[model samples]
Target: MQNFGLCLVIKQELKPIPLQNVVVEANIVDMIAEVTISQIYKNIEKDTIEALYKFPIYEAAAICEFEAEIGGQRKVKGIVKESKEAAKEYTEEVQKGHGAYLLESESKDIFQCSVGNITSGQTVVIKITYVTELNHDSESENIRFVLPTNIAPRYGSSEYSSSSNEGKILNPDVVSYSSKANYYLDLTVTCRMTSTIQNIESPSHKISTEMNIDENPKISKITLTEQITYLEKIFILVVKSKDLDQPRAFVEYNPETQTNCIISYNKKTFIYTALTSQEILTIQQVARVKSTNISTNTWINTLEAFRHDLQLPGKIEDIDTKEELECQLVLFFVSCKQQNGKDYSVQSIKTARFAIACHINLYSKIRPQDINNKNVYPDLYNAITGKIKILTKSGFGESRGADAFTESEIQLIVNHPAMQTDSPKGLLRRIFWHNAFEFALRGGEHYDLKIQHFVKRKDGGIDVIFYQSKCNQIRLSNSNPKSEIISISPNENIIKDYELYFTKRPPQCDDAFYLQSCNQAEVEFTGYWYKSAHVGRNSLNKFMNEIALVTGINCDDRKFSNHSGRKTFVQYSKSRGISDNDVMSVSRHKNPHSLSYYERPKTVLQQNTLTQINDIIYKKRVVTNEAKNQSTSFTAALEFYKGSISENCKFKALAYLNYHIAYYIIENNISPLPLSEKPRVPFQEIKDSQNIQLDEDCIKKFLQGNTFNNCNITFNMNQ
Candidate 1:
């Protein structure tokens, strides 16, 4: 079999100069950094040029400011208007011959900037400012800041590209390594540390640093060296603090809002508590990072902000009593078995702010200072819930949908060698999960598929239970936000696959799957086995990419992911004319809007409407035009003239003659033009005698079964 391949070709040869210079400044304070980027552009072309450029940034960063400077003067500050209003104002200003610039978020991490009416020899400077918290390297306790230099190409279905702001990122030619743009960058950083600073350095570029020893020794200035010219890879700066690794807690109050907040954390869990509106608001968020080192890393996993707010108890003295905390439920209870096989280890869940917040009511009870003097929870159960009520409201959280896979692609992935296993434990695990996914199992629900959740009946039927995120912990009712149970017959392929898998499954790890041994010797190995549900999602994502590569599917991580399977199930079911309710029953999607997102318009070839219409038109045309051989000689005569002709010259000559011949046939209802009025290409001709002679020669050659070269044929000039 041929190797799967994907090729991206730069189709446009006209590379216009888009940028002249870029200037960047960053100021770091504690965990937050504010960055400003300024880009200069000059239009040398005689006509006015409207420049549209897509830029990248840290996904977590919030854009706070924008401005445009025309001809080194006339500054126009950007307003955070609605997208439509911004576009309208930009168009109106540009129509009035005034320079305008509009900046809009393309995605969480990408932004599009449009500069209008840069007249000849005019320079325009556009600046953008944003703020983001610095990411911490857990092992080294160093804070890292990165500025993205290149936009990674995104891939998806045609409908996905058209419906979303993905066109710029999906363009093949706008790559990180493209040298067509001659823009260079000048970057400077000013660092201010709360604790004593150990050092500040850049891994991506050489830097010159200046220390303010006479002033605050903790403050420093750094700039990239002159040799670094291209903004291709990320510009990464790391700052190490001497004692920031210790467990810490702090409280702050905002007088304007009359809000008091306490933040406390060690390493695993972060607690945030806010007192506002006469209510105590507490959130327990977790952080998951794949890399333990400060070295190479791409993704920082963050969970959604889980918020819980309740009215304060009637008496301040009642706060410490357990009776007042009756309504609260510990939402998460994650347990991982250690390799030693005897102990059960508590696992910390990674939510958005796990390392940040502390509820005042709970903090006073646990007295973290008395326990460990750090924010790290002594027990997972304690960290999960502390007199906190489970928030009752249910609604859709913001999440981008993944593209669905084609049927063929799905089959290829399911049939891939990696999925086919004979080992007892591995086989059973793979088969069960693969079948589950085929049956429309969602990523979130996968965690609920434990051994207890599976029930095999005596009559060869099996029922598997799973839970949706909203109703998983605290249930409002049985049917309102229901837990789903999917049943499969014994004779079904899914059952057989599961049976085969379980028979050969390994004995050591009874969990659905076990983590493969780490390749590095020095790395601390977690002996705990993984359930299909608890595996790092990134691992599954990596597997999805591998499947794409092996299946010859044209997809990237952004387009095809673990969620694609669920989407595929929904789309395929809907395409088969299944009602939304029926499909939702199995899929457990509570909202119709969630399911409707997959109902994108079908591709052109899949529409069939246009093809059917064309087919009917062609058939009718065939019936009316009974004389099928009407243009036989004209085609042959054109072929004769085209022999040994230069392609460009032939195209020009043949196009002129063919159009005139077509016109004559349509208007005069003739088979061929008469010899007296021979239709010929421009700068070429055949006189009456020449046409007759050419016909006689063609007939003779046909009779003799002889081929004639272009030299054997003769043409009369326009004279």
Candidate 2:
């Protein structure tokens, strides 16, 4: 009666605060947490009045349960329904003068609860329950559990607030003003961990803890030191445990839903580990069979690539379901490409599958039973067998490794006009070529070569120490040294070439082995031959094309490339009868089979075999002297143009003429022009013709079958 009289006395001056008290209870098992909050409200007004309150909660928490108790006797259970339908029902009930409770989300991290048709002096209780996974602190091994208790006042226009209808709810005119009402908060947290709990602390408020260390699964209870505290800030609880890195798994079964949810925490990431020991062993067995023996980094990178290809989220938890995992795997297998923008090779695809399978086994909730079930992931299984296996059988997207350079081709490249070592460009070209060949360097390996990597031996030889390579990813030099030491003999000309190039290296250049070539005249004057800028990868990769252009070796085939040097080294070693072990040591190949792929018959043997096969098949058809002597007109034309034009120009002119004549015969469906009908424009007339310009435009016209006017030349068979 005293409280009612006091409320009535205050009602004339100001509205009573509806929120009376809040009690929070939380239970944590391993990394998963379940929290329940109860908020009490009282209506002190005379007539029926609505009570509304806004609250904050963890953004990641899933609200699983809600209930309301009105007038301390009637109970109402909340059901998850569409927001609009729920709102409509609540509004209809309120309009009928009946009590209605409505709880809705205001934002991701905020919620609103409204109790309508509350009689004077009536009490209402609201309960909300949610579950979330605790976050792992990146700075330490502690697990963090956060419960937001306060919603700070927003300063800007409420219309722009993230919550829907926030402007009407938070309007200053509609909200009744009152002094800061005295409210009390009570919180208790119970933690159960697989490992022993080392410590428990709270940063937001003072907390007292009760620990039980001797339990098999250690238990701890935490409570606020002050029994009644204001809801002014967020509450935070941090738990540190012994053996935190050890893998742990927990399973929760819902009897009504007839479903199970598993949570596994291992190595700072969450995964589902509901399998028995035997099932885990079975997964390991399958992993061994499908594994590509790649490094851990390579496996991780392959999984990342698969995720990127499928446009999936990076977090494993988001894609841990069976359907999502299966769909992503199928898409990745079908559409993923290599770094070169080409379809992945059969072996590479298999490796990717292996990596993805391992990732699923390690991080996803898709159980082994689901994976092994034929009907569950049919498309994924079919993709693995039909697409990948068919590709393997057909040898689709397989690389026919680069062709090796022959002895004569190598000689041509070394002696070509552009290979002169007098200029900076020429010297760089020479050094790059020799280093790639002599060291069996793969493409892009020379880009990181440094002067410090080339160590001079006491015997006047040089040792090229590779700190890292494709096989040796970790650059640890001590304890488990994987660096390859390649020795260059003192007698090799490449040693002298290296010495000369380094002698002219500029002082401003860094430790990079390859330097940009500068102007020849500038190099001579400044005595600094190369620029300080490091040679780009484009220049290094184009060296083979440059060599091919100048020497005309395999220029038409275009089969030789930067990787040709490594292939050449292997083939050259085999031709010299070098043992497999010796060759593998220099090539840094772990498998002899890899080296055998580069082995082919010697050039002489290949030619001889082809000739022998042809002789046996066709019986060596003999040629008549008339057929052999069919070059009379060609010789006469060459002699006719002699001393009139340069030899190079004369050859080019005759070649162009022959090509056009052949094209004309094909286009007209006529026989070749007879020797007697060949046009013989005198050299003096060709030289004196003003219309016959030997420029690029004239050459283009000639190639296009344009005729010369003053020279009296026409490709007309009838004339």
Off by over 4 Å in 2: 1-317, 335-348, 351-382, 392-397, 473-479, 521-525, 601-719
Best candidate, TM-score: 2
Q: Write the per-residue lDDT of candidate 1 for residues 1-719, one digit (tens) a residue.
A: 01001111125222344456667899987677898877665666677766665555556678889888878868988788898998999999889988887787665656767777777777777777888766666668688877654322233112233322212343332432224556456888888876877888888768888876457878888887765445544467889876555666656699999998886646442334665743532222112121221111110111111111233333221345443332121222222112363322111222311332222223445333222222443343354432121211111123346677777866776676655544323343355346435567655445334555667878887777664443244343435555668777676766776555444333454453323322223222432222223345455445444556655788655576556667788888887678989888767777777787777556744644554455457753331221233244445545655573676666555554455445324422323334365233222244433342345345334323322222123334332
TM-score of each: 0.32, 0.40
Which lDDT value does model 2 have at 199?
86
RMSD of 2: 26.7
Instruction: Please report the TM-score between candidate 2 and the true structure.
Output: 0.40
Instruction: List RMSD in Å for every model shown.
Output: 40.4, 26.7
lDDT of 2 by residue, 1-719 (tens): 00110021234343434466677899988788998888676776778776555555555667889888879987898887898999999999999998887788766656666667778878777787888777775446688887644322221222334433223233221222224557556788999987788889998789999898355448998988875545344467899976666678878899999999887767564545699999988866543322234433375675577677557677543475677777766766676766787666676766666565655566565444344345977988788667766676776747566778888888888998787678787888888788777788877687778889999889888899998776665533446856889998897677788888888898777788888887867777887888888888778778876777777776665476777888888988897779999998888888898887889746755764565456546855433232233234434443444433666766656665565445333332323345355333223243343343353334334434433222334432111
- Each candidate's number of clashing pairs is 23, 0
